[model samples]
Each structure stands twice: as C-alpha cells, then as structure tokens.
Target: MKLTVHTFASLDGVMQGPGSPEEDPSGGFDRGGWVVPFMEEDFGRVVDSWFARTTELLFGRTTYDLMAGYWPQVTDPDDAVAAVLNGSPKHLVSMTVTAPSWANTVSVIADDVAGRVRELTNRPGGELQVHGSWRLVQALHEAGLVDEYRIIEFPVVVGEGKRIFRDGATASSFDVVETQVLGSGAVYRVLRPTPFTRGAFSVEDGRETVALDV
Candidate 1:
C-alpha cells in the first residue's frame, strides 16, 4: 500500500474547511466555503478518478470525526466520494480518541502513528489515501512517509487558515506527475515526493557556469 494524501486548498494554501461554513472555525476562518464556488463537473470527474484508486483512508482526529459525522448520512447512491468514504476502512491519528464509534475505524495514538501507518503501507494495495487530515499529514510528511499528493487548488485565497504545508513541515522536493485545469478555473495536481536536488547558475570570468547537485 502506498500512502497518498488528497486535499483541497485555496490559492494561498489554506486547507481548513472547504465544504461548509461551520465545518471548521478554528482560526475564525470566514472563507470556509471558498472551494464551493469552484465545484463543478470537471472537479467531480477528477475526484471520481481519485476515489477509484483509494483502498483505505488515514485521518487526523478532527478530520476523522468531522467526516464520520457527515459522510454516513450522505445516502446519495451515485455519490462516488460518499460511497468510497463510507466503505473504506479508516485510521484516525490522535493522542485522545481511544474508541472510535465510526464503522471500520480505529484510533492510532501519537506513539503508534508511524508504526501503524508503516504497517499499512507495507501491505499490498493501491493507495492508503489520506484526505483533509492536515495535522496528521504534517506528521507523516515530516516523517518522510507520504509517497504522493493529489490536490485540488481552488482559485480563491483564504489569507488565513490551517495550511496543508505547515511551518514545521519537512523540506523535500516534489515532481509533478500530472496537472489538469477545471472548467471553474480550479487546478488538480498530482505530485510525487522525491529527494531534494538543486542546480546553480553563475556567470564567472565572462562565461556562464553551472553546478548541479543531488
């Protein structure tokens, strides 16, 4: 199983709440529904494609509870996201949540976070997808556990909110696997993490010089 992170973000990288106004008000985020205006068929198509590859899900405590509270009630038979979300097993990372009430869910404490995730990653599967788990994603990222990222970048800028890439995130490089622009101007991007490499260009002694390092 490969660990993949899927998320929706604003142009400025805010990932607090994209669904509803009250979904997350942590930092008094008023632009919670910034991604709503840009939601269209093209965006749905990208999401559907992503869902097709999901085998399981890992989430932060907040994201887990929020999703568990909402997704179960979404009974639309044709809703691809709701379908996959309801069926896939979920692991919630937290120091608190001991007994998860959600079906097919388990609590992963901070001490066991990496160990549990690694166990899942070593399993044979398509993708252990992590969606909207900002804080958990931060820990996984800093631990060098995330293999790829699937993101929907909205056109609006929220200015202030919890970002997917937080301040203490690990320094790593990513290679764009694919990119597609939606009809509503939102862009869907697939990125694979890679070892950081660099190149420097310099003009010395009237000639251009270059140095590359990996």
Candidate 2:
C-alpha cells in the first residue's frame, strides 16, 4: 500500500484552522479559516479525486478528535468525501487516546510506529492516506515512511498557525508528478518522495553549471 500525506495548506504552508475558527485554535490562531474564502467547485473536484483513491486513513490525535467532533454531524448522504472519511478504517497515532469513539477508528500508540506502519503498508495494494495530521506526519517524515504528498496551497497566508512543513522536518526530496490550479487560485500538487541526492554547482567557461554526479 502507498502511504500518502494529503493536506490543504496556505501559501506559507499553514494547515491549521482552514475550516473554521473552532476548527483549530491551539496556537492562539485568531486568523482561523484562512482558506475558506478560496473554496470553489474546482477545489472540490480536486479533493474528490484525492479521496476517491483512499482505502484507509492515518491521523494524529488532534486531527482525529477534530474530525470525530464534526464529521458525524454531516448527514448529507450524497457527500462522497464525508462518506469516505466516516466509513474508511481510521488509524490514530496517540498515547493519550486509549479508546477511539469513532466507529472505524483505531489507535497506534506503540513506540514502534515505523514497524507498525510497515506491517500495514505491506498488507495489500491500497492507499493509507494521512489527512490533516501535522504532528504525526512529522514523525513519519523523519522515519522516511511517507511515500506521496498531495498538497493544495491556497493564496492566503495565516501569519500564525501550525504549518504542514515545520522547521525540523527531515531533509528529503520528491518528484512532482502532477500540478493544477483551481479557479479560486489554489494550486494543487502531487509529489513522490525520493532519496535525497545532492551535488554542487560550479563555474565552467564563464557559465554556471550543475555537477549532478560530483
């Protein structure tokens, strides 16, 4: 299975409190819901495509709590995204949450998160997608367990909030597989993480040249 980190972020990479003021206020983020103004059909379409391929979900404790507190209230039967989220198997990474209240929710509190994730991904051909799990994604990134990234960047910037990519994130590289721009001016990208390969740039014959194999 492919482990994918899917999230909606701002131009500055802020992912918290995108839905509403009450959605997330942990960091005293008064500028909540910064990405709401840019919501449009194109954005929905892109999100729909992203969720369509998800077979399972991985989330952080906070994200799970937030989603559990809201998603069950969305009674729209025609809502594909809501249905997927509510129905798919959810794995929450938390030591505090001993029992998950959500119907299909489970917890991964073991110290061997990488091993457990490997056991999960090695099961079959499916996508174990992580959505809005900023904290958990950090650990997964550090462990080099994340495979793909589907990020939708909004034009607005929340000066203070939890960002998708934090300062201490593991240094790595990825190959951008696809990109699109919605009518709301949101830019979406699909990337595959690859090994970090680096080289130096040199001045050759009065021109700068990249020494990729150096």
Candidate 3:
C-alpha cells in the first residue's frame, strides 16, 4: 500500500484555509479561502479522479474536525466524493483528540507517526491517502513515508499563513511524475521522491550567504 499525500497550496507555500474563509485564522491570517475562485470544472474533475483512487484517508485533528463537521451533511450523500469520505476508513493522527466526530474513523495516538504509517502501508490492501494535514504531511515527508505527492498549486499568494515547508523543516527532493493544468490556472503536479544528486558550490574565503533551496 502506497501513501499518497494530497494538498492545495498557494504560490507562497501557504496551505491553510483553502476551502473557506473561516477555516483557520491562526497567525493573523485574514485572507482565507484564497483558492476558491480558482476552482473550475477541470479542477473538480481532477479532484474527483484523485479521490476515486483512494481507499483509505488520513487527516490531522483540525482537518478531521472541519471535514467531519461538513461533509457528512452534504445534500447529496450518495455523491461519489461524499460517499467515499463518509464510509471510507479514516485515521486521525493526534495525541490530544479524544474522540472522532465522524463515522468509520479511528484515532492514531502514536508519537511515532512515521512508523505507524509505515505499518499501515505495509498492510495487505489498498492505497492510503492523506489530505490537508500540513504538519503530519511534513513529518511523513521528513521520514520518507510519503510515496507520492499531489500538489495543486494555486495562483494566489498569501504572505502570512501556515506553510507546507517552514523554517527548520527537513528538506527532501522530488521528481515530477505528472502534471496537469486546470482551467482555473492552477497547476496540478504529482511528484515522487528520488535519489538526491550532489550540486557544486564555490567556497568563498570570507563571509558569504549559502543559498539552500528547501
């Protein structure tokens, strides 16, 4: 079982509050729902296609709460995505979360998230997918637990918000596996981890800034 992590991010790398204005307000982020206007039919089709392949879903506490509070009540409960989300197996990774509000969900309380995830991936069945859990995704990436990454790069840039890649986070290189251009100008890129290649750098005798692309 491969673990595919899917997330939408701004040009500046912010991942918080792409769905609604009031989704997350931490860090004085006022520009919520920045990715809404870019959702076109082509984008929707891409999403639906991706969700169709997922057999298991994982999320963080906050994202789990947000999704559980809304998706279950969608008017079309039998809709493809709604049905998948409502009935599919879900794993919420958190230490403080006491209970899950959604049905067909379980809480994973392990501190060694990567190890737990690896165990899950090695199980006998389908692919596991992670959606909109930046912290957990970052941790998985650092641990090399993520097999594939589906990143929808929106056109807008929110200078202040929770970023996918932040300071002090471990860096990993990715090779582009696939790319799709949405009608909304958002580019959907699928990346897979690859072996790192060394790059040359000139060493200066005096003080200098070493530019590292994270």
| Best-matching candidate per lDDT | 1
Evaluation by lDDT, superior candidate among 2 and 3: 2
Tell me which residue pairs clash in candidate 2: none
- Candidate 3: list runs displaced more than 4 Å: 75-78, 201-214
- Candidate 3 vs. true structure, TM-score: 0.89
lDDT of 1 by residue, 14-122 (tens): 8898998999988777767777888899988898898899898888888988998999999999898898999888777878788887888754656778888999899
Q: How do all the candidates rank in terms of lDDT, highest first? A: 1, 2, 3
Poorest lDDT segment (10 consecutive residues) of candidate 2: 105-114
User: Global lDDT of each model?
Assistant: 0.87, 0.86, 0.84
The predicted structure with the larger lDDT, 1 or 3, is: 1
**Model 2 lDDT per residue over 29-74, tens place:** 7887787899999999988998899898888889999999988888
Encode model 3's per-residue lDDT on 11-84: one tens digit a residue: 99999999888998767778988988998898888889878998888898778888999899975855888888
| Regions of model 1 farther than 4 Å from truth | 207-209
